[model samples]
Target: MFLQITGYMTLIGLTLYLGLRPVSGRYFVDMATYYNYFQNYSLGAHVTSSKDVVFHYFMKFSSHFMTAHGFFLLMDIIYIYPLYLFSKKYFKQYWYYSFLVLIVSFSFYSYGTNGIRNGAATSLFVLGLCFPENKIKTGICFITAALFHKSLTLPIGAYLLTLMYNNPKTYLIAWLAAIPVSLVAGSVFVSLFSSLGFDDRLAGYLTGQGNLDVPVYTGFRWDFIFYSSFAVFAGWYFIIKKGFHDTFYFKILNIYLICNAFWILVIRAPFSNRFAYLSWFLMGIVIMYPILKQPLFKNHQLFISKIITVYFLFTFLMYFVYYN
Candidate 1:
């Protein structure tokens, strides 16, 4: 009990410290965008997203009571709270591993620092996963998340499709189809988005007209493919070899597969990588859970844990030092 309390408190302290400090260097685009939005709201500039309008006005109203840092602090709390809840409930058997998973998920930090709304949205999505038995509640959470960030449509939409045909073969077919889809995804995306009356910024992204300062999408990212290949194999091993097909880990693996399919198909589309984060963020858990459960590593869990911690910490520190 004391150990659990200490761990939770440490989580809170770390979140507070990181959330308060603004990200620096090349990753400053989204922060700059937020500041621009704040200024625009202050000047009564017309914005397209009513959700953004509400968020902007809320921040404006909040300014009367707190500084900009306070707003970020609140958002940061909202973002992490659901994640903490999900880890506690689902990963209760391996609580420390849950903590390590959160610590190692760099994408979570990227979303939190770059697009806070998406961070909060993904966190809510995590809660939806936690309550999988409650379909209505889960649906409501997913819709609410979409209201915050439309980019969620890719992952959420594909996940819905998975609900229809959940066989591994279906996912495999989708993955195979991605190569052909890559040829036309960019054009089709632009046309469809334009017809749907998407916002200028998003439309520009699809049409390749805007410079949103996001990473340029080169086709067939080797790094993503490498990680994705491992995820696919790990997922298959857990489901087929270990008989964990009906488990939550299997569900996450499937989601990762779907996300990977979309990524492979539309590799050149701007901000397409965001779709993968829906599943990629859960990679730590999917990989760790099965390995930790295996009898071969039971005796060396602590040693393995320490090594994992050191590697992730080194990567995290290097990211901040070099990228920031």
Candidate 2:
């Protein structure tokens, strides 16, 4: 009991420290975007889109009693809650290990700093995933998440796809379909969304006209596919061979596959990294839970834990190194 309290306190304290730190050097542009938006919001600038309007007003409301940093700090803190709830409910005995996974994934600090809105929404999506049986609540969380950041709509769609198709073939199909989708349907895809009233700013971002790094349909990126493919195969192992097909584990694996598929399909879209996080945020669980379930790795689990710890320690260090 004492240990648990200490553990949670340590986690919370560390998260708070990271959250309160100034924006890292690497995310200067992302920070600028948020700062600009917040400033505009405070000045009552007209936010054109529903999503931007919503975020703007929320920030405006928050800035009344607190500084902008305070709002960011709050988002950073709130982001961890869903992760905590996930561990408490699903991981149970292995919750500590799960938390370690999350830390190493850089999901918290990276997203907290670079994509505050998405980070907060992803946290809620994770909490919603904790209740796979509660479809209505999960749907609410998913939709709410997308409203916060448009990229999340893909994950929500992916989740819906998982519900319809539970077979292995869908995974293969998603991967294969990405090639044609990105190559041929790229412009059509953008046009379709534009027709559906995707915000002009978002469209600009998608086309790399809004200071975004990558343009839509910028041809295939082997690097993303290489790394992401590993996650897809890992999901396959857990879902099929590990016999988690009917469990929440399968649900996570399914979500990962579908999100990865979307990421692959739109590998060149501006802000495409969002799709990666949609799945990667939950990857700690998809990877950790199965290994914990296996008996042979029980003793070595301690070694595995240490390795994961070291990896994240390296990650934390790299955040400063790369950013600096």
Candidate 3:
């Protein structure tokens, strides 16, 4: 798995270096400015009033673009390695789990290279997963994440839910009831943002109200939905077969899916792609534990796994090729 991960990293690095000029050429002036802001924030310059200030402080002290990327890259390493350890705690031959981590890391690295809050927030979220049993520690981690990006506050509730429930049916019913309430609140929040004179840049970005067209690869792709559905079914089957009554992870997955689904209904715009990222991230974990434990899938699983892997890789590569 290490070798496989290394190979993927090498290919990605080589692709970026070779394609840098073309990639940069394709980005619009505003997008380019954001990239410069990311690189510049690493040099102590304030870019925005948003919560990225916390990350800005760390990046500024680093004092170089390579240093900043290197820091986050190291954090990514730290965040993902523990996932392997966690999987190994349950399944001894945990090497295969590394592929799951690589898929997530590479996909995020590809789309989120704009160096905003998304990449940093994702790394912190993964790290929070490692400390699931420690609420105080996990809460601190998420609070730091909220400082970098407010969107992260969504999953912090899931961590708390783990402490609240032990039964699957009860948890599912509660979550279903809560979804409508959250949606109403989110709608009210949007109205508040409007009343507060929220910057047009952020509003445009969040609501997809800008001039940018919906890229082909944007939104919930059919292939992704297909694969995620299969993973959900497979995971459900594995848990039932193993007599694993724990509902925490399942509840988390349900929240992620429901949140994304609601965003699709309310937003009705291209930025729905952002919510799709949450879906993929949660589904990756949902798929991982089952694939590790089910002997029935051990032989035929690679066939299906490779398809999803290649689909994401191709989607990300094309996103860069077209949208840069």
Score every model by TM-score: 0.79, 0.80, 0.65
Give the whole-model CA lDDT for all candidates, comma-separated: 0.65, 0.68, 0.51
Model 2: per-residue lDDT, tens digit, 1-324?
A: 754776598678867875687754454447666776666766666566566455566777776677767777787776777887787787676676777677667455667777678788888788778777788898888777776777777677777776787675466567667767777776666455545666666666555566553324455666556646655666666566656544556667777777777666556666666556777787677667666555434477675676577657755764677434
lDDT, candidate 1, 1-324, per-residue tens: 765886678678867975786645355457766765555655656556564354555556665566566777777886887777776776575565666666666576677777777787777776677788899988887776766677666667766866775677467566667756766564564366555876665666555576666666755555566556656766666667766545456566667778777566555656656556766766666666665555334456775576467548755864687446
Q: Which candidate is the best by TM-score?
A: 2
| Candidate 2 residue 151 C-alpha distance from true site, Å | 1.7
Top candidate (lDDT) = 2
Model 3 agreement with the true structure over 205-301: per-residue lDDT tens digits: 4556754434533333444444445444544555566555445556555545454444433333345455455555555566555455444444555
Which clashing pairs does model 1 show? none
In model 2, where do residues sit more than 4 Å from their true spots? 1-6, 23-27, 36-49, 106-108, 176-197, 213-219, 293-300, 306-324
The positional error of residue 235 in candidate 1, measured at the CA in angstroms, is 0.8
Ordered list by TM-score, greatest first: 2, 1, 3
> Once model 1 is optimally superposed onto the true structure by TM-score, how far is the C-alpha of residue 23 displaced, in angstroms?
8.0
User: Better model by TM-score, 1 or 3?
Assistant: 1
